[model samples]
Target: MSVPLFDAATPRAPLREGLRSAIDRVLESERFVLGPEVASFERELAAYCGASQAVGVANGTDAITITLRAMGAGPGDEVIVPSFTFYASVEAIVHTGATPVFCDIDADTYCITPETVRAALTPRTKAVIAVHLFGNVAPVGEIQALGVPVLEDAAQAMGSRSAAGRPGSLGVAATFSFYPSKNLACFGDGGAIVTNDDAIAEEARILRFHGSRDKIDYEQVGYNSRLDELQAAILRVQLPHLDQWSDGRMQAARNYEEAGLAELASLPKPVAGASPAWHLYVVSHPDVKRLEGALAAAQVGYKPYYRTPVHRQAPMLEWGAGVDLPATEHAARTHLAIPMSPGLTRAQADEVVAAARAAS
Candidate 1:
């Protein structure tokens, strides 16, 4: 009767003792900023994602900004991104002194496609950020085939995979978020940049700590952003459980489909050979308002997000000029996310299913 969109407490219950132990370890170490825990988490994260290296940063936005700057994106350099994604994607491009060229999403997957990237291409296109929105892995392999560097905002897709590989290794560089609500969550805000390219990873490492490998020299202008030791330790505890969590979410998504929500709405569809972690379980219904009403009446949590596409937002409006995004517009008008979490129970899921059916 009272299902929340994110059940943070439930997911961490089993790991409570481990989390406490991690915090105790960090407290005992007394090396709070960028210490051994961060190093170990970075190494373990890279290994998990099948990448050569991973650099921890303060948060997901900074991870993207640092990776873009490391990849040589600067003023006048344009990065292609889908407007249907979260605003932080574009904001990161802006922070790196690069222009964000907003594009459309594939109506089904709600992700940018190789075709969309092709449509947004120009001589100044420095890179393309393929966002794996709602845990559906973007078509990174196909996008890379276009020969432009691809940066993945894999914030919602830490455990998701495609035929080529995992999210972190699919693009030229990728970013992951460990916000408490994320699948691979931490105690607080944290993020990482992962890549097979050692050079980019090295740059990211420097960028994460004020442009200096050692404390002595200030090599380049960089923000003071580092994932502190406590958060890193907490993330380490959760990282080992991420694969199992992702599997649970995938199964929950299947349950929704089997319960007949698919008959009433357009469910998220993964690309060929991709396995989405079902981060948000967003759906698009023709009468989305009705669905919203049903969920509300049933005391079930539902969210209508990105109703205003990033291009329409005040700060990024100029980039919207003369840009066409009918698909993005359609998605913005119709889509909403139902309750989904690794800890979501079948009874809670059934409550959601009943509400969705009520809408129909």
Candidate 2:
């Protein structure tokens, strides 16, 4: 039997009854964009994350850019970002016209540490983006002590929490993506910015709709990045199930641990006080290529979250010149994401572990 990397269908099938009705309701109302459903979902999401406000947007990338812009990040400013994260994190920084200063990630957590952020800081540093990579929270409390605004990129960490707080409530502002594959997924692209600061929330709302506070007036130049009503409704349907899905993913991670896969590779290490969402079950080995080949032969799906560190990407090389990120480079070369999702069966996880052992 072929085991795919993610079985979105299995988990989604259970929600089909409610999803069909939700879609029908939207179609009957004929309200497709920025409608009541979007507002309702935003409220529900904010309440879930323990935030005071939430504003829905087009995608996760836009959430970061809009939040940065609202926080006064622009040209002549610098934003510290993790070199090991998805390229979209850096891209959002660039969109705000602020330089992205690359920082190395912690070898154990695979997320940036406060020490790395401090080393990357410059007088021009205006803000920091703390990415909750692979569903594990970054050290928000330590980074916040640096006295600059911190934006939590919780795109992969919907149900995660740290001792500091839930992902959305930890930073000055946080971003979430419901990109069909996240812990709390929608039917299509959707995102939101959650914050406790009233000023930031108000600005994000204006900025997401072409800088318009009202239909006839434009406050500042902004982009069209509103989350559509359909996606919002779909997200609402899935919101209540997020914790259950997260628990299932956590169980899968435990299954991997119990399978003794650690003999072949290193497993993910959650932060001491963190309750991770376990978005991906990633393992690392010096010989990742061999492990991948074995999984392929066994018809078990596997892939690397990031094979190339953002700093090593061609477009980012110039920005990363003279910067050294040993930990990021090592993680990029070694980490491999095996089949991991609430839908993954224990038998399937065992199959993946068996393949890894054979390769080792």
Model 2 alpha-carbon drift over 4 Å, by segment? none
For residues 209-255, could you state the per-residue lDDT of candidate 1 as single tens digits? 78998968978889888999999999889888888889888988887
The pairs that clash in candidate 1 are none
Give all candidates' CA lDDT scores: 0.90, 0.90
Tens digit of lDDT per residue, candidate 2, span 80-168?
99989889999999888899999999988999888999998889999999999999999898888988779999999999888878999
Flag clash pairs in model 2.
Answer: none
- Each prediction's TM-score versus the true structure: 0.98, 0.98
The stretch of ten residues in a row with the least summed lDDT in candidate 2 is: 1-10
Model 2 TM-score is 0.98
Per-residue lDDT of 74 in model 2: 95
